[model samples]
Target: MTRKLTTLLLAATMLLGAVSASHAVDFKIKGVWNMNFEYGSGGNFTERGRSVNGNKAAHVTGWGRYGEDQFEAKSRVRLQLDAVASESLSGTVYFEIGGVTWGRSSKGGALGADGSNVVKIKHSYLDWVVPQTNVKVRMGIQRVFLPDFTTEASQAFDADVAGIVASAPINDNLSLSAFWVRPYNDNWAGDTQSPQNYLDNFDIFGLSAPVRLDGVNVTPWAMLGMFGSNTFRKGDDFYGKNSTGAGALGLAPAVYALKDSKVGRQLADAYSTVLWAGITGEVVKFDPFRVAASFNYGAVDTGVEALNRKGWYSALLAEYKLDWGTPGIYGWYSSGDDDNIKNGSERMPNVEANNESTNAMSSFGTLGTWTLGRDTLIGSTFAGTWGVGARVKDVSFFDKLKQTFHVNILGGTNSPSMAKYIKGAKGVDGHTSFTPDTGTGSADFNSANYYGLYLTSQDYAAEFGVTTTYQIYDNLRMLVEANYIALWLDQSRGVWGGYTATDGSRVGGNSTTDAWNVNVSFIYKF
Candidate 1:
């Protein structure tokens, strides 16, 4: 499948190139392939799917896979429009072919258990840029990212065929971007490869109103965003229907009618019209000395009552470069309980059971890395989090040798993704109980007032690591890293699936799941 997709894409590119060459020929190509060799397998890294960035521990993988090592390659090529000649319009036509045990934000990066492998046209989208107006409009299939969606974050999916995106620079230092995108109309809209992601992909347009400011230093910008729902929710699609329906996935006709309420249509429309805004600024900046802040509030806009959760999230990031190593620190915190859910008395009702309801509505992506010898290592951690992490790095060693240390004593109370662990008594379903996933009825919030169990928010554990990468050649590099994490989950610290978690710590678990991790990766960029 991957080869065919690759061949088809390459052939298509060639054909297009030939056609354009003969006629208007406004097309150009851009491509990049990132390949990796990884070792130390135990952890969620290999199980859930492929980690494009080579992230080591996500619940998707368990602990034992950490020590395992292997190598793989992934890449994408794009056909672009020469801004000078074809005006400012461009689109990408590419595919991926490779094998890896790590999973990424999308199913394309999944690690197959059979090791048979995967290769296909992961994504392709087009964009139109207006250099003069500093405005770029991109439509077709595209990637959509949200503010606080942690894990593969963004409580959403891949691009939509009818999606639209526009980004324009308001001034020298500030710019704004807005997009109306989705991957599914309801549940059964397209390919069923990643049912959870694809079906759950929605029919919505998220708009980010314009905001401008000067520079990242003390500059303030305001942003307003609106999300418009699509036909998938109109009961004609496969996903938005009730779970019991024999159809693909449509809502119950009666419910869709809203019990004959005067505001049925309006309420439904408003539910889809989730609104959110934020103010951000970077006040301090002196080389490594940097300070930035932001506050965002938005309704869940799931188009469902109660599930139409509201949120307020904020963060403060600052950096300071030092001699030993560059020391950096930052943290973010947001309230997930802002959802009122229409008086909180509503039961999980009939609505399509596609994928929308399962979203974590989180923020942050994942950091990818690798390791070398046991104590010595190299890795990269870039996914966003609730902030509260600091680091110091020194790259003066052996030219390629870099000695560094970091501390991420950060944790959030309610994370859609499994950042923290499940502590205390297990729910009826083996999994520790929580809201959204299990609904509000399972675990009591502030009732007994316990960390992982009682709804009381949890604090972040202190996570720190030292890593280094050496350039073996201009296009290839070797990396290794070692990390030490002390989680604050006294009774039920954090739960890392792969390692050895006696209590809550494992291979690197605090009590049961905590243990030192050694990783390594060889990377070649083409």
Candidate 2:
């Protein structure tokens, strides 16, 4: 089935390309393939998964469990087709074949685990340039936006959704873009037991305008997003009326209705609205200096009758080029949850789950570096955290070999106090716990908490690391990195236990006080 689908898609795409080319319209086909090799000292360097919060032990586990010398390889391929239909219209089809695992399958075969590979249509859209106007409309599945600079240290605002985007050039120096985006709606609308019940119907709208001034460009943007099914909420009563008519005996109709309300309320509280503004520009057109900065603030209105959700983030980056290389520095700060789900005057939810205040740093494939320090120390900058780093690029001794070097230091405190949220937990040895009222009972509030189970670790922890990449060719490179981290688990002692502390002083449970890691990656791109 997989092979047949791949053949059919490729055949159809090729046929379209041939026919479109014969029409005299511009048609182009391009692709990129990257082969990656990874080796890590504790085997932890190659671990893959979304970050789990508050799990200090999970973060500290050395990859040695995988093996003393761990090595893994993977490949990715992307194909893009561009066809210009007319003077004012064109279309694009971009597909990405990902998760093509290599080596032995789960059953010990050479191919891979059963059905472990998958393909995705990352972007497929039609572009229509309105006649006699500067407006253009793009409709279909597409990326939210691709920034001109880089998403190395922050990517919290990026998303790919099926939607429509419109852009208008107000003048030669100014332009505006807006988007109304959402993913496909699900079919389990009336199925109470389906996991789809908890999935919200996400509606997102965004507007941004860029103003170019001489050598500098400024973009002011705002996004309004909501998740909930106006349809599902209304169908609550309908389903409730038919309980047991066509559904399983244990799955009551009210369960579906309640799930809708609970999921909607949680999502609303998780990320109600987001507003941010930013500017990007060069210091001198003739010189190699550039800067970009942005600030974002938002709130989660859980409407849970007890909790409040709110968080904000800010970041800045600057770079300069000299005779040898380009040097850059970046820093960011994001609010963390200062209080667990407390009630009354204490109901504070900084950087709430739905608030979307996390900062997206670079990733392995996206930025060519694994977040060793970030993952070990703070999991992700999306929670309450701050960090600064310096990077130098393109240092070359010979024309064929160039190097890029980076060093970053980061710190963070736990958000939402996982201990307070969970039962049967006493305070960490160093931190204080809050027992404020939880007010009304909403569906566990677990939906609003992304942090993991109670783990011993300090609130104020620090991590630092250095990484270097040697580019053997323009499209081929080798990367290596080493990281060190020390967590401040003892908030009471004013310092998390240092290398000398024992489990008695750690929070939640026995957590590592200090950890070290090393990793290397060989990449080839075409």
Candidate 3:
């Protein structure tokens, strides 16, 4: 009787162990490393101010003036870990290291390679599905992007931020998603006398409905935000000095309006409101032929009439797939500021990953690839500009080799009269420089300039690019890219040429040379 009882106890213990093993969590890892070498020239377009001796000096461009080494090497690494218990629950963490430039001592790229504090947490989030329901929820710091079809990247908002997102399928053809994101909070250590956290939060709420049917897919989304007046105050580290936050959101016009209206001085002002709406869709019912389009509108109201902004943007794309490659044509247009700065700006506001970072509009450069690149010399956003381009993507003639070619023509939508309002403009040989505004205690208008080149109706540019890729192995690849741009600026007295020195002489020259860049990169994935 005792032996029989012991055998039963052993069987019960083994059964419990089997049940526990069934619930064990699985761990997975994935990562990528990229190394690159690049060279380029001619980003600066305007000439430096006239010399003291009254002789025209060599034109100074931003690249040359700032001592940007045209030729340099850089590398980046990213690692991601995921823990999964089942199809219903999971967690993820992503880390990034480097983009470290060779010979940069600060990032530990120097001789000893002892870079301090180089690792960054890019993403950390949890995902789970509700019991007995189709609802899915994600929380924590994660990537957030507004739906976009034409450009393949959100022009209004796309980045990583602390947020909560939930989604559910209502039917076979319809689904819904909603999110709440906090882009900034508590970064401001208020005045010594004021409370530490007074009016220092910027939050956004958004919703999107996706519809799918018969080779058709579309998403309509809307977002609303409550922006604290003091959210980007002067003393704060990241958002202060207009470095990030507002600047990263392409809100230069709003910043300019606030400073212009003098409303920013009043500490009593608590909050401003922002709203955006957009729709994007794609139709592949034609099979080999595809069409996609996107339209967006945004507005910001700060109570003061002179501190309001509203604008619209639209884009279209058409492509046909072939055995060897896909040929496509795309175009975009966005509203720009009128001649009156007092009426605020008409340019559409957006939230991009970084200042002047590339979007999918230019596929050969910047954000289009898994690895990042320098954006076009002209500008990165569709705001205040219009453009049309053609491309052949994924043209492959050999095994493990592919290539893409692109050509784009760009023009400005802003008024030429607005250029005259720019203050603290100065020219430095080999670069661009701005003089400080000592009188207003206000930020320099030049400092709020968002677009690298503030093109007006009189200015235009042409760009060409090509990218080649070769798979070196299952988890490794090599890439080579080349790009060129030609710019035409109106040098008339009514336009960019109107600037003059104290001596009433033209400050910069009338002509600018074209710019070009070449890049070689190796990428490994695991």
Candidate 4:
């Protein structure tokens, strides 16, 4: 991705399509398939839960690591295509693959990389529309905008050649949304190719960028109206460092000869920058008060900051949705960027110049772009599904029994030095991307901090379900539903391990260090 980074991403997508332009572009490019054709029978969940593999401040320096019972998938298939979008312009082709005759899976959660059957091209792009004020913008190799709902995990999943966006709506209250991304932070879907690689820092916050088939993102934005986004760039790409673990380097081996030097990827291990701006609408509507805020100065290494590497970082976030019940209550906060004595200041590293004397937080910080579980929140949770992974009849596999207790999920643990134990991160043995505190944990069921990160959640997320019947015959009935989640941590990571304990006799966590992930899925709906 170099041709001057592809001409500064097409001059930042035509200067954001010359700003404030949008009108006629009806929009509709269909064909997005989702398949899960199940038959019957199920059983698996030993380490099935806290798979906490890597990313999310992996494991501060013992470099994060995870490997257990993997090789599963009963039935699945997916296909993507746009085949249509109406005026101005649009195009598509998104590939998909699952199951394996060649990609074969004995069973654990199957997809295939060597189990055979793995195909990719995920997305391609093209878009244009600027005649009035409808803001129809679309740029190449896209999709990297952390819009709510913790999808499979976080750590500020980065992505690039990017730009996620919106603009157009001055009347329904307000309008505008954003992304100026720069990802390629390696992982490409993980589980293969390891021999000491190390490229993952164009920071797109929290991993996972799959929205190809020619890029295009839209969000006319409304409600009191205010939105802002920023993704930065500087260069050098050694990417955050937790150092020490698996092939240990633990700082001082002259930091691997300055990452094998050439002024460490040009002028001391360069990472980049992004700045965000915000203002959201709807400040009083019957029972509403919606607002958003952003103030940023950039320098990112993904998932909050992961040890600053090169230099500088800054951030802020806000949310207030009060109307009570249904969908309300979401709080946010962000602030990163600490490192002065800039531009080639003493050749970077050294825990990124000791994170400029500590404010301690940025193992992929948290708040929007959701770094990594600062409380994996879910709003008023409830769930359902059945056959074909059924999405509702009672949620997830037609139910015969169920239970509830207002839900919200995602667990906690991160913040020790900056997590990220190990796995891919540009081919393993890179000793994780730092941030300590057992590099985030879960798979057991503990720390739920008022329910989030991972206490228990299903039915999309943030749950509340209840099913009870005991008919026995006729059509048949006999069920039990009892699922409750509320695990928590940040009891202040045992209050900063007794302030970096010298021996006040705190010995930092491990009564199995509180981890959580609830389970209860029993079914038979006929």
Candidate closest to the true structure, highest TM-score: 3
TM-score list, all predictions? 0.58, 0.69, 0.85, 0.23
> Among all windows of ten consecutive residues in candidate 4, which has the lowest summed lDDT?
382-391
List per-prediction Cα lDDT, in the order shown.
Answer: 0.38, 0.46, 0.69, 0.25
Compared with the true structure, what per-residue lDDT tens digits does model 2 show for residues 1-526?
2673567488767867687668866777777665554444321221232222233323324433222224455555677877877868888888776534356352122453344344667789999988889789999987675232333333334545689999998899899999887742453355553355444454667788888777777666666655433222334432221222111111111111132233222223432332333333333454588776666555434344222345566667788888888888887666554433332111112211211122223222112243221222233223355667777766766765556665555554333244333221333333332221122221121122222212222344344555567778787776666655544444332222111223343233222335455555565555
Which is the winner by TM-score between candidate 1 and candidate 3? 3
Better of 2 and 3 by lDDT: 3
Better of 1 and 4 by TM-score: 1
The digit string of per-residue lDDT tens for model 4 on 52-86 reads 22222322221011112122112323334442336
Better by lDDT, candidate 4 or 2: 2
lDDT of 4 at 326: 23
Candidate 3 lDDT, tens digit per residue, 1-526? 2343345347545644654587676767798999988787665422211111111132343233223467767888887877777999998878777767778776657876666556677899999999999999999999888878888777788878899999999999999999999998987677864577778788999999999999999999999987776676665322222444665466545333334223434333478788999999999999899999999999877666455678889999999999999999999998988877556679887776322223555743224545644453554457788999999989998999999898999888988766544432332222222322222232133333343566788888888888899999999999998888777877775665535654555454233556777888999999
Model 3, residue pairs in steric clash: 60-430, 65-430
How far off is residue 238 in model 1, in Å?
A: 12
Task: Output the lDDT of residue 509, model 2.
Answer: 27
Candidates ranked by lDDT, best first? 3, 2, 1, 4
Query: Which residue segments of model 4 deviate by more than 4 Å?
Result: 1-114, 124-126, 130-134, 137-361, 364-510, 513-526
Can you rank all candidates by TM-score, best first? 3, 2, 1, 4
